[model samples]
Target: MAIGDWSSRMRGAEPCRPGTEKNKGVAVSPSPARRPSFREVFAVPEFRTLWVSYVLSAVGDRLALVALTLLVYDRSRSPFLAAVTFASGLVPYLVGGMFLSGLADRLPRRSVMVGCDLLRLLLVGAMLIPAVPLAAMIGLLYAVTLLQPPFDAARSASVREALEGERYPLAMAIMGSTTRVVLVAGSAAGGLVVALFSARPALAADAATFAVSALLIRFGVPARKAAASGEDQPSPLGQLTEGIRLVFGDPALRTLVGLGWLAAFYEVPEGIAAPYAGRLGGGAVAVGLLIAASQLGAAISTPLFTKKIGPLTRLTWMGPMAILACAILAVTVLRPNLVASMGIFALSNSFAMYQLAANTAFVERIPNEKRGQAFGLATAGLIVGQGIAFALAGAAAEVVPPSTVVALSGGIGAVIAGGLAIRWRGMSPAVGRHTARHLGREASLTGQTPIHAARSN
Candidate 1:
């Protein structure tokens, strides 16, 4: 949709009228606009540079993951170790996010990002050395992932700073779409490399990407606030707590985080089902197809997320919408086999668009200063939620079929998520005490519609 559409809908957006206690969740109006035309994402020199760096790094992430999995399998001939290689990397995601990501806002965005890239480069390079011990390879993987969340937070906060107002949702859409594309591209490229010359070439390629990504960050991003002034600051751990506190303090944010947590729970089967598929004799290529199918569906349905009315609204259909999405994903696990699992994943992804819209709505609802922590907390919630789901699914794989557990989890997630969405969809815009994100762009100060306002969120 056009900026004008979102502006009109958001401006005139009303709170839910109180009837039962049910309407308490979504009865607030969105505060005055954050900005007018956020569509000019690439217009920012720094963001464009980061975007390029991000795309390259995205490819590298996939390559590293694939190469590591293959390398571990080749060395040990143990499925459990290979699975550990894939799953254990995520442990740092939870820990780093919980204890470290708060440094994103507290530190210079540039230094945090550049430092992360270099750290990952060195770790990945370590993995590329053939003479390295098996434990050394695993250690390097853990280190690389441990550094992920802060870098992720820095990039997220910088995007909000770069694209104020109507452009924020568009930026999210672009980023989401880019992520899907990267997953597809990276996974495919990783598989091809593994098939051709084994995993070392892929690891080296990933390391190369990290090295260049670090260099580009130095060239493109501005220095940290403390570094620029030579001032000491609070620890990253302290900053992380502040971010968490900011997120929980706001009503709107709480709703967003809640739903995000549910979404994370709902998503684990998508990953776990791959190994399940492999166990059913679907093989590596089958596992790849399963991922590709779902993502393809997600890619096609991504545009629906730019909805102007937003999911966090009185007019929003987001609650049942989210429920339906989860129901679809869960039911995918009730299938007869892996092929059915893949098909269900593809179908479920289409239904999952509602969740994406809900996420964008949450972003739009949050104030400027808190956006860093809010988004960071939201990201953390997602990681935490997914971890729970993954762990549960993995455990379930030992007792019952993974597909069955996936379906059960999906069903439970849908019921809970649907109920939560229904309750929160009644919440008003709740924009009390909003913060200014930046200097206003001259383009839409009067709230005038753009000349080229062709509808395309």
Candidate 2:
């Protein structure tokens, strides 16, 4: 399918070719006897490699942040400079997502990912040079991260092709849960690796991981052509703008993206974790524990929710869960104790089911051909929104109490969640019923007892 044709599909035009189902917003149904096990998703060799590479790459990125922050602080003795270095990791997403994301769709997905890994490997390798100025090192870091969104876009788009029918949700849940778990583990491990050895060694390790990731992608993933095919292709900027237009123009897509953007506010507490912990008379350990608690909540809840709840039921719960999370977080403004705040933070993140549901819906509604750009746009919006919230909350905390800023962020998130819930409530019944029945059949199929025939009885 041509790239220009996606807008028509988004606008409810009939599927332009055979095998394209119109109104794919509804969940897919597979026969009970034919249902695939969630574990079977990993049995697909390509997806297994992708999942492993993602975890390794994500861990390396997290580790690099710790090493880089320490290296900058040690070299310059300037906390502000170190902070700027940290922000570079996030700020690039806005530019990269808007201008560079089209490259994910314009190039073969595997090539985009493999090329990104190789480029980052080279950049990080350069940072290891002792003679390189701190300014140049920082610049290299920024350039290294510019490739992140597009790589993520390509990886997510590939998942749609790797997993089919009921397996898609399972794959999404696994990926989401693994990410939360890895973030916590990676952060702590990164700090320890830097402390035990040194920044240079930690960075060298990260660079090597990128090389390994590149190799994994090259060997494991099948080569495929770009999504767009035509004599007169539009500019990259035009493609990105069209992607944005298509997302906002579709009701389900708009609501899903809105939920994702609202998460920016939800993430404000993490940005202010240190100050909030300080306000409670806690130290670095306290900050670590709080972050761990929040991640653990998401890691535990995502898989449980995916296993027990069907997609349709998950949709109904998304808005309410998001509101409850933020509302509970807002209550933390009452100056709760350390233990109490940690519990509340954990409870709030347990609602990761909201994102998982929205993501599944997004994958269902969007055309496979446009998945890269669509995922890119969604991820970029989340990063940009969250980056802004992080900056605003941090800045506001200078004048107001950190807890207050955190609470305000939550309150704002609640308001947004309420709006989404109201808009989405009416659309869930049919979709939810369809998804629930589909999942019910899969569960029964997986759980059914084997029989030797009535003759034995």
State each model's CA lDDT, in order: 0.63, 0.75
lDDT of 2 by residue, 25-45 (tens): 334332333445667988999
10 residues in a row with least lDDT, candidate 2 = 1-10
TM of each candidate vs. truth: 0.78, 0.88
Prediction 1 global C-alpha lDDT: 0.63
| Top lDDT model | 2
Candidate 1 structure quality by residue, lDDT tens digits, 85-195: 887546787777766665665567778888899888888877766689877888789888888877886777676666544565556666676777788889788978998
C-alpha lDDT of residue 355 in model 1 = 56
Superposed by TM-score, candidate 2 places the C-alpha of residue 235 at a distance from the truth, in angstroms, of 1.4
In model 2, the Cα lDDT at residue 69 comes to 85
- Deviation in Å, model 1, residue 34 alpha carbon: 15
Separately for all candidates shown, the number of backbone clashes (residues 3 or more apart, or on different chains) is 13, 1
